[model samples]
Target: MSKANRTLKKIKHQGGRIVPHLILITYMVIALFPILLILINSFKNRASIFNSPFSLPNAETFSLVGFETVFGRADFERYFLNSSIVTLASLLFTLLIGAAAAYALTEYKFKGSTFLSIYMAIGIMIPIRLGTVGILQLMVRFGLVNQLLSLILVYVAMNLPMTIFILSNFFQQVPVELKSAARLDGASEYQIFGLVIPLVRPALGAIGIFTMIPIWNDLWFPLILAPGTKTATITLGVQQFLGQFVSDWNAVLASLTMAMVPILILYLFFSKQMVRSITAGAIK
Candidate 1:
């Protein structure tokens, strides 16, 4: 090849690599900007927060009054515990049942299997909030109103459709020979399903993060079915700081900042798997 042609090709290759990284960096900055703003202002006094919302906290403006108020006026510990319980429980059941259902629909050729899959997919298209009235009534009939279990059940149901949809695609991609080998080794159906779970860990991580975020951040279901102070999730608990006429900006920001901690931790924990999934999809 001519030197000029080779040089042009090298530049194109380098540009292809550099462009994606630059775009990713830009996207991250855009996404994190609001969270950063909230964190900075959460440490500032209320007046300073309003006066300089985007500025970093300085010695003059910095105060822990917001944090203090958040902890003082609310059962922060209980709210955190309730949210943890509901979110984790919902994720656990959603992944387990969704994985099982996906495996069956993909591996087994049973009657009505196609219809069942379609029925579940329909949930993904329709917003769960549209059935709020019916769900609330069902909760009331079951005497599960104002209970954490209600939130768990509702979240699991809400997330299951998408979970099944994603996991089904991944499960279908599992090599048939692997399952046949497991069978030859006398692995029961349950054992074979268990064996496939690790192979799809990336998909699980992606779905877990996607599913947990909505549940953790949800306020509508909690408000309708489990609004009791003892059962309030962090999102619902944060509402105490928001008043019609006199809102505590400092406390509200502080509470929001604190509420972000769990989601951030989970994202960090599952980030590797998510990256692997995304990279694999890109390669394919």
Candidate 2:
């Protein structure tokens, strides 16, 4: 509490910020700088791009050729929508089924509970791509190939493990007394899920994110299961666009920049919820 001691402590804290700030600033540059480069270059002419790839857009260099070509060649807005629909539907189905299964695993004690839980965990480490040949044939048998529904179904199955793992851990942290009391008050299991699940929504927000990123970013399943130009997700569409216009620097950069926009917007919007939800029940 002495004045000299307080001054020393403040100095130490001030010095501590330097390393962390340096690290943060370094990483931010590494992450954002490239995207910024692509975005600015997208607005620049072919000659200006080589002249100053990193320079700010100005009257001398700015152009919209990339944007023009991208818009002209493909239905980017539709591709964006396809990504959204598949991501959203897969997220919904994964969380619903995963949460329900997690609740059952955590809330009920039974003979094969441990075995069943272990069985579900097996999917986590396994890459479903290994089964592509069989999956393709099976889809053909069901006439589901080339459909967005096929992609949605595969994504749900793919993301189920982590979702169940997350929700189950959170469910276990919900006090046993709460569930018993809800039951005594005549709440059915479905009623309990309806009433109680909302309380865990911050956790769900975290789990929803964990499920969403892969589905949204995925290229393999979309390539294999639903490669139709009509139903292509943004990732695949952008890939196809880039391949077709490989020589068009402006269009290529534009497509990359366009693809980055929705994800960046989403991360900015839900970031706090995502972090909090993941760490919500850690101490308990």
Candidate 3:
């Protein structure tokens, strides 16, 4: 090819790559804007929050009153602990059971396996919230009402279907030779499953972040199942600042800002793996 034609082709290739990155950056900015606003306003006084909602905290506007109120009026530490416990515990159980189930369905040949897979997939289609009444009754009967365990159990059940679906697809993509090699090396079934899990780390990261966000931010389940002060998740605990006639915007914003910390950490931790997974899928 001529130098001019070669240069044109190179430019075209670079533009193709740049365009997607531009789109992604635009989307990221759009998504993070609200969170940015919350964090900025959380540091400002109430008057400044209302007067210049989008502006950053300045010398005159900056105040710690919101943080003060939040810490003073509520046991935010306990709420944070409760939410962390429930969210992490739910993710742990969901991943374990879902991964095991997916491995069984994909790797094993058994009776009713197809039917069982279909039955599990049904959970993905039907919103778990639709069965709230029944779940509440079951929890009540089990004497788990107002308990963090109730939230953990419910969240695990809620997230399992999607987890299984995603993990099963990833598991299917695992090279047969890898598993065969493990078997040839005298690896037991459980050991082979362990070997497969690390290969699907990206999928696990994606599932962990996906499953965690809802469970952490969920107010409905926390409100219904574990509304007690001692068991309240951060999302529900923040509701205390919202009153019938008035709301403490400062404390509310501060609490929300603080509540977002774990999510940011999780995203930062798992973002690389998720990007790798997406890029890998796109390449294929």
Per-model CA lDDT versus the true structure: 0.88, 0.87, 0.88
lDDT by residue (37-123, candidate 2, tens digit) is 888888888888888887888998888988899999998988989999999998899888988999899988999999999999988
Q: Candidate 2: worst 10 consecutive residues by lDDT?
A: 275-284
By TM-score rank, best first, the candidates go 2, 1, 3
1 or 2: which has the higher lDDT? 1
RMSD (CA, Å), each prediction: 4.2, 3.0, 4.5
Candidate 2 lDDT at 89 equals 93
TM-score, each model? 0.82, 0.89, 0.81
| Each prediction's number of clashing residue pairs | 0, 0, 0
Error of 3 at 166 (Å): 1.5
List the pairs of residues colliding in candidate 2.
Answer: none
What tens digits encode model 1's per-residue C-alpha lDDT throughout 56-139?
999999999988987888788998899899999999999999999999999998899999999999989898899999999999
Best model number under TM-score: 2
- Candidate 1 vs. truth: CA RMSD? 4.2
